[model samples]
Target: MPPTPPSTPARDEARIRDRGDACPGALRLHAADDGGLARLRLPAGRLTAHQVEALAVAAETLGDGRISLTSRGNAELRGLAEECGAELAALLAEAGLLPSPTHERVRNIVASPAAGLDGLGGPEVQLWARELDALLCAEPWAAALSGRFLFVLDDGRADVAGLGGDVTLVAVRPGAGQEPAARQESAAGQDPTAGRLHVGGRAWLVAGADAPRAALAAAGAFLDAARAAGNGAWRVRELPEGSTPDVAGALDRAGIAAEPVPPAESLLVHAPPLAPGPLGTASFHVLAPLGRLTAAQLRALLPAEEVRLTPWRGAVVVGAAPGHQDHARLAALDSHGLITRPDSPWAGVSACTGRPGCAKSRADVRADAAPGSARGLPVHYSGCERRCGHPHGTWVDVVATADGAYLVDGAPTPRTALPDAVTTARTGAIARAATPSTPAETTR
Candidate 1:
């Protein structure tokens, strides 16, 4: 591995913030350096084609004519006209993207993009995400959750398990010769006990064969702990180290048995991050180059009714009609310059929109970022020390220093030597996995 970056911002520590979560939502817009920015949470990053077209229209008419894909699998509209709030809200509501204004921000849920489509987690997990989302919106007390509070519905893959979800539900396989059930716990002929529910770094078997309910129970437990802490904590990890809620007890209270599924040790496996490329037979997944999608490009994905966004700046084109091969659509997307191959030079490359868009940025990192090979871990180019939007796991860090040189993992190097230096670091003969810090599953 490229000599482990000497300085990677702490990933496991609970973020201590004195200020409330000011994360913008569809109704609430944050005045960004570029313009008014609106973030619309997509429960599990699921979006219908109609919704996509609506967002495209909104971007074209009310904002920058471009939609930015956030690292959280949500959609962001930048350069919004200052007076576009009423019109924007109306548009989003009509699209059914804004169901609960009160709980819009709290609907920060992300699930495996290839779950049901690719059989990685099956259709039940994505369904659980939707069900849990409805549950969250229906509960008045859930409004107390900070906009930053996250729920990860992973399909037993490590892809999102470590993304720092305060509450996560990981899919578990059923016992051999056993089928899985939907809402009941371990019923005969049912799927694996709706997987397992994990909170912070600890995990427990879920009660209720219904994985969705178990997932919701985990959220309620976090809510209980957050309220008990009374520190306005927005995440389970932030509720003082020893205070992770009794998830088992929470299930018991909810009338679901708190079955012990597996220990934290067993659930700590990290799946290698999924790269941009074709997924499954018909699903075509692509990354947004640098997580930015233009209005036209966003609409190009409408060959189907819906697509699934991923936390990794990628999206899976799903909902295609059966037997409808996406060869032409994939080719068209490729023609539009979207990354759709795993071996492409852009596989693990990313950069922040520096220069004009962000006044805090000192350089145009995107323009300066060279085509990257997939030999090393993911590398991100940041304009300044803030290093906004860096990867979560073992990856390379390249931050632009004021002197025109880039700081490659804390060591200052000329921009000219960056490519070789990064390559060597990534292609190092010895590759090792990062062990879980606390058996606590998050690097979020």
Candidate 2:
């Protein structure tokens, strides 16, 4: 079983931000120890084959020769020259990846990657994401949103509902005699065309056609609550205690009829990520090792009509031929070093940019974590205590220490023992044994 998560911090202990977030976007590049880093948000993680090729070209010519996948289903180009910001922006814009300059940073959105292609789940929520992105860009007020604020759209499969989102919209599964429509309420008082909109701890039933606008309204409500509280909260979870956003009121003002759902009945269903493999007959899911893809690996996914990056640090290649042909494609991806099987050791393994790239890092954690063995739980290797790009929920936490050693789940271990120690921690053997005593500090 996954270990229980720690309790939420007290209101007084919550983070208080006095300045805006400095998250990098296509228009805004962040200067790191390695070089300039540009984050391009792919709402719903949708990318055309041409867009993929364009990113490959950008990475090879302007920045690092590799692309890094963020936990939020976004892409990052590192090792860029400071003067290439304008050029990078132009490249992305030409590829249609940068639609709105003002709303670039705030375009953080993730949806069920296998929605319509998988033959499971309800109404395709990817379409909903596109509509929401358009609505967000058109609204000038949305530019005020922090770059980290996220909107999650689940296709009733519960794939993305668990990902922490400021605003979440989940399609409601239709009954035997029902069909999805627009703004139509059934005789039983249920809206067949409605979805469950969750903001903070509250949830409401909203029409499918109105869901995109309702999601934006929810964000606006959060902004209002944050302003009233003067907490400068960037996410809904960061709002002051007891100051939940007035989502219902916001919906009412927008002329969107919303039905309040009781807290007990509004609990979201959590589902594991879509494992790497073929999904039904239309899509092939594959993972990038350590969430980094070489230019060659990126091109290996070509001939795909569309690619949807998943929040799990993988992608769903859509419009693939079924059966033998899809299997052949998966094999090709495997040849190029992508994780095409769930049993691959690289599965559930992630690491933050360490070593020369991040000045704060004490060691090259990624280099050390590359030989990791497969285990039951996910394992994340962090260069420092900040634990950037860590996975959500319970997992093995490996942090590099000042003494040039590692702390596997807080148990100090030497560098030479990392492999065995990490495997033990990930397999739950460390949790079952008596805690080890703190050892004397030692250099690697």
lDDT: which candidate is best?
2
Cα-based TM-score, every candidate: 0.88, 0.91
Output candidate 1 Cα RMSD.
4.2
RMSD of each: 4.2, 5.2
Q: Kindly report which residue pairs in candidate 2 clash with one another.
A: none
Query: Cα deviation of 247 in candidate 2 (Å)?
Result: 0.5
Top candidate, metric TM-score? 2
In candidate 2, what residue range of length 10 has the lowest lDDT sum?
A: 435-444
Model 2 residue 127 CA deviation (Å) reads 0.5
lDDT (Cα) of model 1: 0.72
lDDT (10s digit) by residue, model 1, range 302-401: 7775788778887788855344466667778889888877787677777766776777777888777865456667777778765666666766677888
Assess the local accuracy of residue 384 in candidate 1 as a C-alpha lDDT between 0 and 100: 74
Backbone clash count for every predicted candidate, in the order shown:
17, 0
Please identify model 2 stretches exceeding 4 Å from their true place: 1-8, 176-193, 370-373, 429-444
lDDT of 2: 0.81
For each candidate, the alpha-carbon lDDT, in order, equals: 0.72, 0.81
